[model samples]
Target: MKTTFKKLAMPAVATASALALVACGAPADDTATDETMADETSVAQEPGTIVAVAQGNDDFSTLVTAVTAAELGETLSGEGPFTVFAPTNAAFEKLPEGTLETLTAPEGKEQLTSILTYHVVEGAIDAATLTNAIESNDGSYEIATVNGGSLTATIQDGNVVLTDAAGGTSTVTATDVAASNGMIHVIDTVLMPG
Candidate 1:
């Protein structure tokens, strides 16, 4: 079946216009404003799946290559509604010397796939939802990943941070990059599951 994709941009409020405000109605509170902003930011992109969305973004090139190499492109493209904490190319660069190269090699596909899957949670979790989850869980929440490991979500310095199984922490650099199937939260560091 053919797919349709959407492009989303955060801080979608480029400028304030009286007409826009009058048409949409004003938000009730600070929380309401944030929720409204999040809703407005979810714009549509090209017609495809989450995999295509990641491929289209230059920042995620390394992630795309890794996913393809790991033979997970199709699965990510499937009807997921997944929450993908995609690490940037710079994040991959943060790895130790030879780490990325070794992981991308044919023999390292299994390990690479495991690590990549660790970044994914099997649902559509946007910033507001995640914040709510954290609040409900009393400041931090543990999430089981597709790779069968778990990650901890917490608020630090007023931003959402994810702690992986190996204890490395990655801050959510960008949130709510909406796709056809799910959402992408950009991270500066790759989460290690082992």
Candidate 2:
């Protein structure tokens, strides 16, 4: 029995050593297979699954301001498959100087929520799916926003563009940030709810 055990252990140790060598980039017969497996696992994992990207990003200052003003920090941080059209700081800066200040005022909470929710879609929509929907609709698609109003979607230059009821258009700058509960798409301009 002892000799049998020793023989089994010898092969096991050799196999482990061979695996370690392969992991360290040593030439192996199945290196390609290993790499493929690694890629698959990594790709399956989602990146930036938190609202931290919205908070930490300097370019999203306007969005951050609105979120803070609306007291939606906790809600957005909650489990959500929320697609946010996050306007850049530069986008907000385009507004009148007092516009942001007024929006963030204490009495403007309701209005702030309306504005922020207008930018949010309930589902994760990638640029491709949005484009397909628009094309199938004869160059236009409608998305019901969290604010209870529908926004128009159009395909432009191979990108999905959203137009608010106020005649403002926002282009999707980033897409498909997957989270545990949902996905987020970053936009370049604020979307106003009608």
Candidate 3:
């Protein structure tokens, strides 16, 4: 395990290694108070995790709220080095009227989690890598999300575009927003996994 992480840069590797223990199911229930799990919570307070980054950035306020509502903070912040196609605040605003409200409601957590996970892919896949994959796959690439759904990536007018499961399209407005445990690519529109 140690040998595998030798490739990551300084801060990210340290964060990933420490959080990974808790992420891999270190049992944090009241009956089994694992030290690692407690440490994970404290570790999340630092600025390396994706959740921390999102919380610190005003542009991702909506995304942060959705993540919290879905109860995916620990997973996204700890069990990763993930590639998250993060929707910006403006992107969340592009949702249908009342859509965000409905999704954030407690009853909508499962569906919201599914939708959010559909935007995440394992590993730190940067834009250049995505572009290469698209080119290698003959101008498009079918990338599977953390959820069972998939996203199709294609280039449009010199920009990377993602086609969601519902056939709605979103352009990648920004690429490679680095987080300690992942990379965040900001998208202008929310991709639904309908």
Candidate 4:
């Protein structure tokens, strides 16, 4: 009985070690079985659309509301593959008095739409792409937004920062949030077009 238990424990320890190595990006040992390695590395797929990703998070409720009010819910929910710089609820709160409320109003839909479109670049741009673009462009990369304006991107203090058309600068607080349709980079400030 003791010999049987010892044999079982040795294999369990080896399996745990292999999983730890895989997580650290170490090359798997030739002795590691294919089934165990596969199980340890599998990741569940997330939803595809930008709208779906935003709607799933509480931090994006304000953004979701604005998108709906701007009548862009359908557009964003479409086959976008768009890169969105999403501003959180707290970011929206930083706006002047009555700004968010007014933007969501029926009368302000067009304005709201413009503001939202200003945050979207046509393709999914990950952090690495932005960094590469910046390097190729002499430390700053200009990105054209859906609103027809441009944003200047640079790396500052190790974070990706976007300078809007109005010269307002917003730092990306989170990056590379993946969706099947595209990617999302969360910003600390709501970017406005000039």
Candidate 5:
């Protein structure tokens, strides 16, 4: 399927806007705005964006490579309050043989971006918020993804489990890894979108 990214704006322009906001003085909530600005600024001035956070972790090498192949580094690094369910290297290894190669190849860029974006939600959803959502929504909550897909989240054995569009499951190994642009929850499998 062809995936047209209508949600994400140009990363360069987003970054510039962030910088300009900081330069021009922020909103009325100076304290809160300062904190937000710091987070966004760190994404560019320091290794603090979601992309940078993944690149720094050894286990996310495969994810990093896929993001690079998809040319989504800038977008993921931009001023986003995104929530990402990051799959580890072991997760990528679990894909059918040669799947990784295809996803990372130039021809596979579209599918790769779609898959990558599927793991992301528009807002920063922390573990507590996720658990609350699950509890409040009749034991399962449908999380809308950036790729125009949905992931059903439920609690299993005290761990958060995500059901992809293909009905594949991924357990959240770690939660609430903070980034300049958002939060990252480590998942054990790569989520497939239907």
Candidate 6:
């Protein structure tokens, strides 16, 4: 998994740069303009773009590592409407010492995948929708993840808090980075998978 990070990051960056370059190379004619517009439209249409942006952030080192370890870098980077509750590196550091290292080990790949998948829902759910769902549900909202587990969302101290299958909790610190495929909500703590 440690090696996986370096391997995956490079390709991800190259792909993004290539996409950017292609987006920038359009000619100034009406047809080219329309094509450029369509390109932008497609890029904006992807919901997982936010995950790419989040992955590029240094604050998300642990999240990146987990993604690599779980072998989910490609999946999250793919086109889809996914709502991710991303935790910062500091959140991972708060875990017991050696926990992170263990999770990245070969034997722990399954667990790592489960934990990371717990943070993702199948569709783009914005903050407003999450808030309204919680409010309408009397402080509890249920979300089904792509991993087949369920997460329980609720409002605590005016913040959206998500409970994982393992009973671990993560509070949404930042919300709503719109991508063509989904939305991202930054969390202060990593929610461990049950």
| Candidate topping lDDT | 5
Candidate 5 residue-wise lDDT, 54-138, digit = tens: 8878899999999999999999998887888999999999999999999888899999999999998887677888898788888
Candidate 2 vs 6: which has more TM-score? 6
Judging by TM-score, tell me the better candidate of 1 and 4.
4
The list of candidate 5 runs beyond 4 A from truth reads 1-47
Better of 3 and 6 by TM-score: 3
lDDT of model 3 at position 138: 82
Query: TM-scores, in order shown?
Result: 0.76, 0.71, 0.76, 0.77, 0.77, 0.73
Summarize candidate 4's per-residue lDDT along 80-168 as a digit string, tens digits: 66888999999999999899999999999999999999998777677677778777777787888888887888889988899987889
Clashing pairs in 1: 6-44, 6-45, 7-43, 7-44, 7-45
What's model 3's overall lDDT? 0.79
lDDT of 6 by residue, 51-130 (tens): 56666577887788788888898888777667788888989988899989999999989888887887887766777777
Judge candidate 5 at residue 73 and give its lDDT. Answer: 94
Worst 10 contiguous positions by lDDT, candidate 6: 1-10
lDDT of 3 by residue, 1-194 (tens): 00111122323433342233233454556676567666766665344677877786788899999999999999998857788898999999998999999999999999999999999888888777788888878887888888978899999999999999899999998776667787778899999898
- lDDT (0 to 1) per candidate: 0.77, 0.65, 0.79, 0.76, 0.80, 0.71
At residue 143, candidate 6 shows an lDDT of: 78
RMSD of each: 11.7, 16.7, 10.5, 15.8, 9.7, 9.5
Q: Deviation in angstroms for 59 in model 5?
A: 0.5
Worst ten in a row by lDDT for model 3: 1-10
Q: Which candidate, 1 or 6, has the higher lDDT?
A: 1
lDDT measured at residue 69 in model 2 versus the true structure, 0 to 100? 81
